[model samples]
Target: MDQMFQIGDSILTVSLPVELDHPNSQAISQQIDEILQEQYIRGIVFDFGNTTFMDSSGIGMIMGRYKALGMRQDSIRAIRVNRRIYKILNLSGIYKVMKICRQVEE
Candidate 1:
């Protein structure tokens, strides 16, 4: 699965692929970091509409980004997560740490 990222004026949206496993972790992390460094980012939004699988590494990826944004009083959000993924987020306590929305509005 290919990971794609898009940056808007107020947010960075990472369009994660079908599986967010180890193989794509480094690439996603590096791309996110680069985007963060290259922009005066206000927030990050993870679009999970197409994601079919995510393991603990995926949890770590989101947590890492959450911690990064916390330092600057910013935040990261997750959107369009299906029931299975929502359970993962809930079980990992990520739903408490980040906002999960039904959609992204401009």
Candidate 2:
């Protein structure tokens, strides 16, 4: 299992890898699915602090999770998003579906 996952209350936080390509996205999706099956998760927080690159697969992964959570816009979040990732997210229209934050709240 990937140590990137962290659970708190009903939320699942995923610390993404440096590069979010097809292989990485697929593995992350599978891991998140398994965790969801074992526990009731209402929201997902994607930590993109380390993610410098993301392909379309990453968008798909995020969208899949959003749908899995009943398509509630507030059920997904992106934290520690740098400028580059933010542009991608903006262009992908992900900002409309999930909350984006420049920093994680302590």
Candidate 3:
């Protein structure tokens, strides 16, 4: 499946695609920007259950949202991240800015 976005309780949950490369990352970033402009989002949750590959563009996209959200603590989250993606997130220093979870939080 492609990327999907869901919003609830002021949080935006982004269900990422299997491959988060330059092409899709740019599109996803634009879509998320539109959503941000239209809604009163308090946080963002990136769901990586179906994602297996991610490039630097993906990391940049997430960071863009972090900045868009005013860099609030716990305002960004990564859930269902696999080992490979976890390593990427960790090495990209995303762990320092966002919450990384093995499972979705309620």
Candidate 4:
């Protein structure tokens, strides 16, 4: 997984890997947590541009982040989601927790 976190303005952008499974998801989850603790994040954008596969662990990762940010009322958005992954996210009911953006703000 490409593990890169980009921050601009009030948003933090995280580009996920092509396959968001257990190992990578764990790393990502930890990284995101570290970033949240270190930065003043107003919003989070999870970019699934290169992601082609995701599993239950990925769902857990997303949900965990969503709930953590929710406590602070920090907004979260999913971006660049293709149809297949979008279906997974939809089935997991993540849209109810976070906004799904058509285009992510830079």
Candidate 5:
């Protein structure tokens, strides 16, 4: 899985691969953690334009990040989600904590 992080003044944007399943969840989590530690991140924006699959591990990863940022009064957001993934996010209750945006697919 490939991941990229964009450091911003207030928000750290994370772009993850299309398949965020068990195989790469750990790596993704580690990457995110490292970025959070290395930067003064106030919020996270997850770009889901490329993500196509996710599992329980992905949910755990998101939840863990949420907790990590919660301590700092930060927030998380998601963009460019497809229909299938949107349903997963809804069922996982991520919508309660993160803002959802309909971005133009790249």
Candidate 6:
């Protein structure tokens, strides 16, 4: 569970873990929800560079944050999504809600 947050401007860039499954997914959602509450976050950028696998819980987590952010629809994004995970997001219609970038963070 390697996660790090890089705050940029009003974007809360989050580096996700390799396996974003249950338990941790719920924890991550809770943590992000907490931040959105006490802070003035305007957007979120999820970095999926290291993520290899994920379950439906990942989508739930993202959706939870999107709703919690008051539907700041255009501010949510996902970065460095590999083919496998990209398929997951694509099939889940996540791209319609957030931007997908193949660029990895160096």
The candidate maximizing lDDT is: 2
Taken over the whole model, the C-alpha lDDT of each candidate is 0.81, 0.94, 0.93, 0.84, 0.80, 0.85
lDDT of 6 by residue, 38-74 (tens): 7788999998989999999999899888888887668
Q: Give the TM-score comparing model 6 with the true structure, all chains together.
A: 0.90
* Estimated TM-score for each candidate: 0.87, 0.95, 0.94, 0.87, 0.86, 0.90
What is the descending TM-score order?
2, 3, 6, 4, 1, 5
Candidate 1 lDDT by residue in tens digits, 3-50:
477776768889988999977766788788877777777788899999
Residue pairs clashing in model 6 are none
lDDT by residue for model 4 over 1-105, one digit each (tens)?
Answer: 234799889688999999999999999999988888988877888999899999999999988887777644438878988888889989999888777765555
Residue-level lDDT of model 5, residues 2-72, one tens digit each, is 33878778687888788999877788789889877887778888888899998889878888898988744
Q: Which portions of model 1 miss their true places by more than 4 Å?
A: 1-3, 71-74, 103-106
Q: How many times do residue backbones clash in model 4?
A: 0
> Which residue runs of candidate 3 sit more than 4 Å off their true CA positions?
1-3
Residue 43 accuracy (lDDT) in model 3 = 98
| RMSD of candidates 1 onward, in order | 2.8, 1.3, 2.1, 2.7, 2.9, 2.5
Order the numbered candidates by lDDT, best leading.
2, 3, 6, 4, 1, 5
Better of 1 and 6 by lDDT: 6
Candidate 2: what lDDT? 0.94
